[model samples]
Target: MLQIKDLQARVEDKEILKGINLEIKPGEVHAIMGPNGSGKSTLASVLAGHPGFEVTGGQVLFEGQDLLDLKPEERAREGLFLAFQYPVEIPGVSNMTFLKTALEEIRAHNGLPAFSAKEFMKLLREKQDLVEFNTSLVNRSVNEGFSGGEKKRNEILQLAMLNPKLAILDETDSGLDIDALRIVAGGVNKLRSSENAFLVITHYQRLLDYIVPDVVHILSGGKIIKSGPKELALELEEKGYDWLREVETTE
Candidate 1:
C-alpha cells in the first residue's frame, strides 16, 4: 500500500535518512527498529509531510499516488494515520468536539455530507467500544492532563475512528506499562484487517509479543540492513543489536 524509493531527508542542514527504500503491502505488519539518531523518526516525519524535515530526494507513493505532493491534512483525508510518539494536547477543544470536527473534515474530503450531531456521537460510541475508551476522556479537552498511557489510548481511539488505510505507529510502546502496552496492542490487533497495512516502529521486542508482525526489519544508519520474519525480533532481543553491529564491522 506504501512504497518509498531512495528516501533521503534532513532537518535544517543535517542529513538523516540516506537512500532508504522500503515497501509495505496491504494486510502486512512491518516493524522498524534502530539505534538512537538512526533517522527512524525522521522517516516518519518526512512521510507525514512534517514541514521541518525536507525530502531533498526520492519519492513516497501511497497506492500509486505521490504522497509528498499532498498536504498533511490531505493525506489524513486520504486514509493515512500517524500516531505520534508524543500526542499533542489541545486545551480549548473538547475531545468530542475535536473528533466531530475532524470526522466532518474527512467526510467533506470524501464527498460525503457532514454528519449530524447524533450520527457523529453514534460513531463515537462505537469506536469507543473498539478502543475501550472511557466517557470521561471524551468529555475532557483532547490529551489535556492525560497520563502517558491515556495519551496512547487516545491515539488508538483516533485509529478506531479514522480507520486509516496505512497506520504508521511511531514508537507506540515507549513509556507504556505492561498492562497499558497490552491494551494498546490489543486495540491495534483488533484494527488489523486484510485491506489495511501497519508500519510499527518500536525499540524493543516486548511490544512485538503483543502485536506480532508478519515481518521485522532492522534499521541501521538510516537504512534497513536486515529483514526477516518474527523470529528475527526474538533473536535481536536475545543477542542484542551487537551481533548486527559486528556483522556491519566485518562487512
Candidate 2:
C-alpha cells in the first residue's frame, strides 16, 4: 500500500533520514526497531507529511500516488494515519467533537455525506467498544487529563474510527505499562485485516510480543540495515543493537 524509495529528509539543515527504501503491502505488519537518534521517528514524521521536516530527495508513493506532494491533512484524507509518541492535548476540544470533525472531514474527502448526530453517536459507541475505550473519556477534552495509557488508548480509538489504509504507530508503547501496552496492542491486532497495513516503530521487543509483525527491520545510522522475520525481534532483544551498529560500520 505504501512504497518509499531512497527517502531522504532533513530538519533545519540537519539531515536525519538517509536513503530509506521500504515497502509495506496490504495485510503485512512491519516493525522498525532502532537505537536513539537512528531516525525512526523522522521516517514516520516524513511519511505523515509533518511540515517540520523537509524532504531533500527520493520519492514516496502511496498506492501509486505521490505521497510527498500532499499536505499533512491531505495525507490523512488519503488514508495515512500516524499515532504520535506523545499525543497533544487540546483542552477546549472535547474528544467527541474532535473525532466527529475528523471523521466527517475524511468522509467528505471520500465523497460521502456527513453523519447525523445520532449516527455519529452510534458510530462512536461502536468504535469505543472495539477499542474498549471508556465512554467517560470521550466527554473530556482530547488527552487533556488522561494518563499515558489512556492517551495511547485514545490514539487507538482514533485509529478504529478512521480505519486508515496504512497506520504508522510511532513508539506507541512508550510510557505505557504492561497492561496498557496489552490493551493498545490488542486493539491494533484486532483491527488488522487483509486490506490494511501497519508500520510499527518501537525500540524494545516487548511490544512485538503482542503485535507480532510480519517483518522486523533494524534501522541504524539513518537507514534500514537489516530486515528479517518476527524472530528477528527476539534476536534483537537478546543481542541488542550494538552488533548491528558494528556490522554497519564495518560494511
Candidate 3:
C-alpha cells in the first residue's frame, strides 16, 4: 500500500534519512529495528508529513498518489496513521470529542456521511471493547493524567477507530510494561486484515515477540541495510546491531 524510493530528509540542514527505499504491501507487517540515530523515527515522521523535516529528495507513493505532496492532515485523510512515541496531552479536549471530530473529518474527506451521535457512541463503544480500552478514560481530557501504559492504549484506541490503510507505529512499545505491550499488540493484531499493512518501528525485539512481522528490516545510517523474515528479529536480539554495522561497512 506504500512505496518509498530513495527517500531523503533533513531537519534544519542536518540530514537524517539519507536514502530510504522500502515497500509495504497490504496484509504484511514490517518491523524496522535500528540503533540510536539510525533514522527509524525520521522515516515515520516524514511519512506522516511532519513539517519539521524537509524532504531533500526521493519520492513516496501511497496507493499510487504522491504522498509527499500532501499535508499532514491530508495524509491522515488518505488513511495513513502514525502512532507517536510520546502522545501529547490535551488538557481541555476530552478524548470522545477529539475522536468524534477526527472521525467526522475523515468521513467528510472520503465523501461519506457523518455518523449520528448515537451511531458514533455505539461505534466508540465497540472499538473500545476491541482494544480493551477503559471507558472511564474516554470521558476525561485526552491523555491528561494518564499513566504511560494508558497513553499507549489510547494510541491503539485511536488506531482502532481510524482503521487506516497503513499504520506506522513509532516506538509504540516504549515505556510500556509487558502487560501493556500485549494489550497494544493484541489490538493491532485484531485490526490486521488483507486490506491493511503495518510499519512497526522499534529499537528492541521484545515488541516483535507479540507482533510477529512478515519481514524484519535493519535500518542503519538512514537507510535499510538488510531485510529478512521474522527470525531476523531473533538473530538481531541474539547478535546485535554491531554485526549489521560491520556488514554495511564491508558492503
Instruction: List runs of model 3 lying over 4 Å from the truth.
Output: none
lDDT of 2 at 119: 93
Q: Deviation in angstroms for 212 in model 1?
A: 1.0
lDDT of each: 0.89, 0.94, 0.94
Q: How far is candidate 2 from the true structure (C-alpha RMSD, Å)?
A: 0.9
RMSD of each candidate relative to the true structure: 1.2, 0.9, 0.8
Off by over 4 Å in 2: none
What are the TM-scores, per candidate, against the unseen true structure?
0.97, 0.98, 0.98
Task: Give the range where candidate 1 is weakest over 10 consecutive residues by summed lDDT.
Answer: 242-251
Candidate 2 overall Cα lDDT vs. reference?
0.94
Please list all clashing residue pairs in model 1, or write none if there are none.
none
Q: What is residue 66's positional error in candidate 2, in angstroms?
A: 0.3
* Alpha-carbon lDDT of model 1: 0.89
Q: In candidate 2, which residue pairs get closer than 3 Å at backbone N, Cα or C atoms, i.e. clash?
A: none
